[model samples]
Target: MSTPQPQTHQQAAPAPNWQSAPGTSYTSPIPVTRTHLGHALTSEWTKIKSVRSTMWTLGVFLLLVVGIGLLVAAQTNDNDYADVPYTIPAFFGLILGQICLITLGVLVVSSEYGTGMIRTTFTASPQRHRVLTAKLLIFFVVAFVVSALAIGFVGLVTSGMHGGASDNEWGGTVLKGALYVSLLGVLALAVGSMLRHSAGAITAMLGLVLVPAILPAFLMMSESLRTVGDKMMDYNAPNALAKIFEIDSENGGGTSQLVLLIGVTAAAIAGAYVLLERRDV
Candidate 1:
C-alpha cells in the first residue's frame, strides 16, 4: 500500500517580471530640468572673473580714472575749464578713460576668440542669440557696476579737492557716467561680435569716435563739409553724456546727441545679431 503522499501544493505560478516584460518600462517618475538664461548669465559671470584680462582691464580703468583725476586736481588751483564742471577735476580724464573702457569692452568678446574659448562657449550654449544676449547683459552689468564705483571714487576725491557738489547733482551725474560707460561697453560688445577681430574693432571704434572730432577740424575750410563736420562735432555725443554726469557744460547743450548715440548702439547690436544668425560661426 503506497503511503498517502503528503499533499504537495505546486507553488503559485511565478509572478511576471514587470521590468523586463515586452510592454513594461522602468521610466523614472521625476521630471528632467532644463537650463535657463540666468544659468548662462552665472556661467558667463564665472568666466569673466576667472580671466586675467578682466582684472587687468578693470584695474587699468580704475587707475586711469583716479590717476587722471588726481593729476587734474593737483594741476588746477581754481577750476578754469568751462568744458567740464568746475567742481570735479576728473572730467579732464574722461576722454582718455573712455578709450580704456572701450578697449576693455571689446576685449570681452575678442579675447574669447583669441583663446579659442568661443567654441566652448557656443557648445555650452547652443542657442546663439541667448548666448550673445547673455554676454551683452553680463557685459553691461559689469561695466555699469565698475563705472559706478570708479565715478563714485572720482566724485568723492574731487569733492575733497573742490567743495562737494550737491547730493542731488552728484548722484545724478554719477548715475549718468556709469550708464554712459556701460553704453560704450555694449557698443563694443556688438562691434566685437560682428567684426570678430579685437584689433580691428578697437581701431574702428577709435576711428568712429575720433574721426568725427578730427574731420571737423580739417573741414572747417569748406562751408558744406564744415557744416556736416560741425554738426557731427557739435553733436558732441561724449560731451552730452558728460553733461548727464556733471549736469552743466559749455559744449553739452544738445539732447539729441544722446538719442543718436543710443540709436547707433542699438543698430550695431541688431546688426551683429542678424549677421551672427546668418553666418557660420
Candidate 2:
C-alpha cells in the first residue's frame, strides 16, 4: 500500500475456436468431387427431357411421322411399292416432321441463352467446350434414337401392309434415312449454339432445309441461273432423303449428301467451340 503498487492488467485470451491451429485443415460438410462429361450429360439429359418444348415437339413429330406414314400406306396399292422401297412413304412425314426437330434443336441451346440460363450453366461447369460437347452428345443420341424408331415403325407397317410388294433391301434405306435426319438435327444444334438466338437460328435452319429445294423453281425464269438452281435442287435435303429412300431423284446419291452434311456439321461444331471460347458468357 505504501509503494502504490504498479497496476497489473491481464489481457483477454483469444477463444480456441477463433484461433488458427498450425498445420490443421478444415473439411466442409458437403462432399466435393470433380465434375466431368458424365455429370454434364446427365444434366443435359434432365434438361432436355424435362422441358415442355421437348415433349410438345417430339409428340408432334411422332404424330406426323406415324400418322402420315399410315395414311400414305393406306392410299397406295401394294403393287406400287414394287418400284419404290416400302420406306419411301416415310419421306412425306419426315420432311414435314423435320421442322419439329429443327425447332427442338434450336431450342436446346438457344432457349438457354434466351432465358439467361446459360449463365448458370457456364458458371456451374466453367468449361464451355465440355458443356457444348455434352449438349451435342445428348441431343444427337436422342434425335437418332427417336428418328430411327419412328422410321422403323413406318418401315415395318409399310412392309407388313404391302408384304408382297416390299423390296428385300429396304432395311439399309430406312437406316440411312434415319441417320440423315439425325444428322440434320445435329446440324441444327450446331447452328443454334453458334447463333444463340432461337428465332434467327430456326429461320436459318428452315431456309437451309427448304430454300435449296424451292428456289430452283423460281430460278427457271432466269436463263443463266437455271442450271445453278437445278444443281441446288439436286443437292437439297429432300432430294438427299429421296435418294436414300430410292425415290425418283436427279440427285447424285445419298453418299455424297451424307459426306457433305458430315463435313458441314464438323465445321459448324468447330466454329461453335471457337466462338464459345472467345466470347463472354
Candidate 3:
C-alpha cells in the first residue's frame, strides 16, 4: 500500500536466429539421403500395394485360375491325366485368368494418369526411366509370383486327387506357364504407359491378344491368306498357353511364344521410355 514498488521492465526476447551465419548455410533438421533405383522400387511397391484396383484384379485372377482349375480337375478321372501333367487343369483356368492380369497391368499405369497422380509420381521421382523400370519389375514379380502360386496350388490339388504326384515335368511346366502369363502382363503395362488411358490401353492389349487369335479363322476363306492365317493361329496367346500345357494338337513347345513376347515387350518398353521422357505428364 504505502511503498511504491519499483517498476519492473522485462527485456524483450532477442529476435530468433532464423538466418544462417555469414559463412554457413542453414542445414535442414531432417536428414537427407541420395535417391537411387532402390528408392524408386520402394516407392513403386508402396503405390501398387495401396491401390484397391490391384487387390480386386488379383483377387479375380486367383478366383479364375484356382476356381476353374479345381472345377476342371473335379470333372476328370485319373485316365484324363494319363498323358498330361496334373498342371494341365490349371492351363484352362489361366487362359481366362491372363485377361485379369492384363487388365490389372493397364490399370496400374493408366489409372495414375487418369487420376492425375502421374504428376505427383514424376515429381517424386524425376528419372522417368527409373520409375518405369520400377513399375515393370514390381508388376512382373507380382504377376509371376501370383501365377506360380495359383497354378502350382491347382497342380498340387489335382495331383493329390487324380494321381500324378510322381511326374517330374509338372514343376517346370508350371514355371514356364507362369512366366508366359507374367510376360503378357508386362507387355500390357508397357502398352499402358504409352497409351496413358485405361480404356484405350486395355482395348489395345485385348486386341493384341484376342485379334490375332481370331483373324486366322476368317482369313482362311481366302486361298492366298490361308498360310498367313495358319501361322497366326499357331503363333498366338491361346495357342502358346495350350502348347505350354501340352493340350494343343500342334505339340510345339512354347519357346517361340516366349521369344516373340520378349521381343515385343522390349520394343514397347523402349517406346515407353522415349514417350515418357518426351511427353508432358
Candidate 4:
C-alpha cells in the first residue's frame, strides 16, 4: 500500500498433448505395425500347433492309419490283394482315423469359444473374417499334408507287401482319399464355427458323417426311398472314401462324391462367414 505493489502474474500450465510424446516429437513409445492376413495366419498356425488336443488327435490319427494299414497288409498274402488295390487297406484305418480329424477340427474353433478365448481373439484383431480365414487356411494345409503323408506311407508299405498286386493306377486313389478327408476336416471346422460349442459341433459332424450311412440300412422297407437311401449311403463319407480306394459304390463314379462334398463344404463355409459377421464374440 505504501509503495504500489508490483504487479503479480501467474503463468498458466501448458495444455496436455497426449497425441505426442513428452518433451519430444515422437508420437508413442510403441512401434505401430500394420496388420494383414499373413499376421493372422501366423497366429492361427501358432495356436493350432501349440494346443495339446491337436497333438493328441493327430497322433491317434497316425496310429490308426499306419497301424491298421500295416496289420491288414501283413495278414493278407500278396495273392489276397489280386483284386484289391494296394491302398485299399488304408481305407479301414482312415475310416476310423477320420473321427480324429473331425474332433480336431471341432476343437480348433469350438475350444476357443468354450474357454472364452474367442473374445480375446476378436478384441486383438477386430477383423473376425480375417481370423477365420487364417484358421481355415492353416488348418486345411496342415490336415491335408499330414493326411497325404500318412496315406502315402500306408500305400507304399502295402505296395511293398503286395509287390505283384500293386497297381500303379492306385496313386490317384490315394491322393483322392487324402483330399476327401481333408475336406471333411474343413467341413467340421465350418460346423464348429456355426455351433460355437465343442460337444454340439462334434456331435453334429459325427451325425453328418455317419448317420446318412446308417439310415439307408433302415430305409429298406420303402422301395421308392430305398433307391434314394442307397444313393445317400453311396455318397456318404466312408463309402466315398472307399470308392476313392477303388472299392465300388452303387453310384458310378466320376467325381460325383467329390463334387457333392465340395458343394456342401462351400455352403457351410459361406454360412459360417455370414453368422460370424452377425454374431458377437
Best by lDDT: 3
Query: How many pairs collide in each candidate, listed in order?
Result: 1, 0, 0, 0
- Candidate 1 lDDT, 37-126, residue by residue in tens: 998899878878888878888888878777887787667653443334442545555667777778877988888888788889888888
The residue pairs found clashing in candidate 2 are none
Q: Per-model C-alpha lDDT, please?
A: 0.74, 0.87, 0.90, 0.88
Highest-scoring model, TM-score: 2
TM-score of predicted model 3? Answer: 0.89
| Selected candidate, larger lDDT, 1 vs 3 | 3
| Residue 269 alpha-carbon offset, candidate 2, angstroms | 1.0
lDDT tens per residue, model 4, 33-61: 99999999999999999989999999999
Candidate 3, residues 42-65, lDDT tens digits: the string is 998998999898999999999999
Clash pairs (backbone) in predicted model 3: none
For the record, the alpha-carbon RMSD of candidate 3 to the native fold, in angstroms, is 4.9
Could you give candidate 2's per-residue lDDT for residues 53-116 as a string of tens digits?
Answer: 9999999999998999989988988888877777777889998988898899889999999999
Rank candidates, lDDT, best first: 3, 4, 2, 1
Question: 37 in model 1: Cα distance from truth in Å?
Answer: 0.5
- In model 2, which runs have C-alpha deviations exceeding 4 angstroms? 1-8, 14-29, 249-252
**Candidate 1 residue runs with Cα over 4 Å from true position:** 1-31, 77-87, 164-168, 236-238, 245-254
| Candidate 2 displacement at residue 244 in angstroms | 0.9
